[model samples]
Target: MPIVEINFDGLIGPSHNYAGLSFGNLAAMKNAGAVSQPRAAALQGIAKMRSNIALGLTQGMFLPHPRPNRAWLTQLSTDVDSASSELLANAMSASPMWAANAATVSPAPDTADGRCHLTVANLRTMPHRSHEWPNTLAQLRLAFGNEQHFAVHGPVPPAFGDEGAANHMRLTPSHEAPGLEVFVYGVAGGAFPARQHVEAFRAIARVHRLNPERTLFAAQSEEAIAAGAFHNDVVAVANGPVLFAHEQAFADKAALLDTCTRLVPGFEYVEVPAAEVPLTDAISSYLFNGQLVTLPGGEMALIVPSEARETASVWAWLQRHLAGNGAIRRVEVVDVRQSMANGGGPACLRLRVACDPATVDPRFLVDDAKLDRMAEVVASHWPEEIAVADLGRSSLIEAVESARAQMLDLLDLTQLASG
Candidate 1:
């Protein structure tokens, strides 16, 4: 009955492109229309997973939904025969590559029924990402439908936007222990829209039957939101007793940390002072967005992007952090520049779930053999570079469809493919 946290990363899909569809994501906007390498992106992601496996970490993967997302196109009354308009451009978005937005998972330890609960994100705030719920839900139901241990709920009502785990954080003394669940939402933000609604956050907690005393709802700072910390994960991340964040990450940050200390034993707060690293630099380098993972030897490691290592301020901060030798003892820099170009980082590409492996769906579990096969498919079939102008080309569509279909076959998940 021992429980462990598994990282489920989304395989960069064949349709990976720089469409600049996300309004709040600076990199997505800056790199809009640049040529994207689907093959390189997928390989980089797979390689990261492999490295984690080598480190004895449990890893899983979620396949990308087929694109140009016919379900979305049909909703706009557009068909393949006449789908050449720019209006359908966002429909081709590969936003699903950021699986942290996939769904909010409540481990059995935190739920009242003692069953793990997963609710897909509505993602209704953005036109480009709004269509992902149905497809994401399909994958969830198929992978977690073993009803004895899991209860997969539909997306929250569209009236209230839900951005999933991107805005949720769970704090436990250990994977098997029931602990406090923190739901971060934004109320007053600048021009950029606040994605996680307060109502949605409350509803999710209520539906999961989380103990009210153990649940805390924190407000994301407006400054962080304006600086492109569109999701709470961008500004803060949690791993067991440690909550790593920026000084300005949340509104009334001191009180929030105080509450966590009172609620969870051995709770630790690690903050990067605002004077040391400005919000601009934090968002640009994604310093706070790094994945805080508990290593096999009972120590924690920060899996960060190369950008963080390259940025002078972030680099200095990390060096000092490692020097402190507190909860986070190691720093591993990964090259996910392809994904970073679209405003996602190591943390953004994954969803962390704590549970017993036997209770979960085996189809999603990843091992060395499966990783090799998926890498082979990427090299053989995925396109090296795709431009915005080429998004509507029949040849590009054929290549994307073929590559995804083959990936599904290799994973024995052909059922997820569009017929």
Candidate 2:
């Protein structure tokens, strides 16, 4: 009954981060220090609105609790917010088509299991929402048909940042074109040791054909009501190193690195405490191309474009401990500081869509030249097109939804009968 089978593969979706192929060291250093006149001038408007702009920009996707909120902090975060917003806008305006977004999914070799995803947040926000999820998922949906027999992981109930936690959702598609099988989890509560959270995520891994005993890499956040949630399904691996245990409230720097004892082969990262690893020094990013997009919840492959990529580091304590893994993509580029400051590198800006169970998908297995050419070809047809990587999620969804509708109309049932 399913077009694709579930494999114990992992997540297949787009994400945005603060690391990627950088513009170069000189450019990065030039911009690294305090804001320049023009840059500062641009930030003035944002700063006036809020005082603490830097923190907002540097803050990880999710941070832990107990940090005092000061009036100055708001101002600095606002600056970060303003800068991030402008960068996201630039990325979105760069895309030529709505293909940037696709159904968010993970690979599952079991039956038709997969991950289902749809984000429920103001993606327009600077570092937090910004263009990462929206742009990544948008193009993916476009490359792969939207609403397919795949999985979707998105916002749950109570909204993110609500009740000191965010709600996440996973959908299993029985059908595409509004595709869904079962909403693996329509409403999930807290992430730490909560049965509700475990059951919800476990449902997705089961779809992916993953053994309940296997370990899973999960994105963590101290502010997350869902801390330690991933441990329920399988072992959880996190990328960001530095997390504040729910019990610790602050953060245990030593414990952060201790968690890094486990790392997947081919990808190696040992946890290092924040005091030891400077956040601003710079880090390298990786690329993911032609990789199979696996969905754990939905039990099917969601549509992914040709590639996806990312780069990340665990600078904050809260994010590191809670999130088990950063992103795992092939390392293509390195040290993209300018790009990183804008809040994401190559991998951070992509969304994957494909149901291929193999390590590689033939259609997606092209070299970088071909991938660029594909974007070029698509761009030629539409002048408004920017890099598929640039567009935001809302714009991406609008594009893919249109594509599916058009594809349905153009296919002629009569032609099949004649052939």
Candidate 3:
């Protein structure tokens, strides 16, 4: 089978808001209580998918998980009407928009069974994101249901926190070749929570049947995590044979790269020094959170948020990087400020699955026409803005529900509404 990388982005949900639910994320906390533009946010996400398609990359999408999750509220033994402010915010969270946290996927070439395996993330570290696994699992099953080519597993036990692909990186010579899977875990992050537990990723490797020799586990630097690089993706990203990261991203950066150089053929790295681009600048601008992708012509490009361009240090380093003869040849800037304000950038908005697109559900795959249709629905139905205090309004709840239903109906994915 010919394998290609498909970036499955989660459509920004209609209930998208900034209640500052994520503690370790500086952007989220900085923008707390701010009004959010759901319509603009969803449209921005669609535009991003369109840009990837224009670049000759395969693009897929995961619908927003049902919001105002009444089921989760009921699980807490309280109705939305009577729930505390915190409980209501948790139930109404749209954190699922960051699809990178949705799951960890090991491509067929890297797994023991020669079939792609996906494990839904428990996201157990945070209250608002903890209830996402069940719905995410349902979507994964539907999209990659071909048992002969794909194996979808439920979340590992909640005792250990797992933030999914955000903390995972796979390095390969080619998309079809077996790869070196790197799982980055955090032990301490000052006052912040370390979301990816070591044991959780170990369990995923076992479940995916990945070879221990080909799998590497690395510890995220406590400084990086304390600087608000909550997930590894915020400080490092790997594509094909190249690993682009901050010099301070890992606790043992030299050792990690040494192992990759030995295990991964033609492994190359571009490490930005903290002196050039301070860790604070990297985290605030989300420079490392950008997607480092191999374009169709075999040249590599970094897809970054516009914020990266606006940051002086980040932009300066990127220009110098482009001027040099580096493996990453180009930089593509995109507008995802809405997601950025909520602590997700271009990379955080996507989950990369390397597989033959034909084996996946066609409904999840997209073209320009599909993007056009989805954008229309978002513009027509999604809320203009959501104020923090408006979360409890009956009118806003109805609007949010109706907007998602219309999107589901348009995509012929109403089945997900009930999941």
By TM-score, the best candidate is 3
The TM-scores of all predictions, comma-separated, are: 0.98, 0.33, 0.99
Error of 1 at 270 (Å): 0.2
* lDDT tens readout by residue for model 3, 176-221: 9889999999999999989999999999999999999999999999
Cα lDDT listed for each candidate = 0.89, 0.26, 0.95
Stretches off by above 4 angstroms in model 3 are none
Expressed as tens digits, the lDDT of each residue in 263-323 for candidate 1 is: 8889999998889998888898888778899988999998999999889988898898788
TM-score, predicted candidate 1 vs. hidden true structure:
0.98
What is the C-alpha RMSD, rounded to one decimal, of candidate 3?
0.6
In angstroms, give how far residue 61 of model 2 lies from its true place: 23
Clash numbers, per candidate: 0, 104, 0
Model 1: residue 203 alpha-carbon error in angstroms: 0.7
Tell me model 2's lDDT, rounded to 2 decimals. 0.26
Q: How many backbone clashes does candidate 3 have?
A: 0
The order by descending TM-score is 3, 1, 2
The worst-scoring run of ten residues by lDDT in candidate 3 lies at: 79-88
Which pairs of residues clash in candidate 3, taking residues 3 or more apart in a chain or in different chains?
none
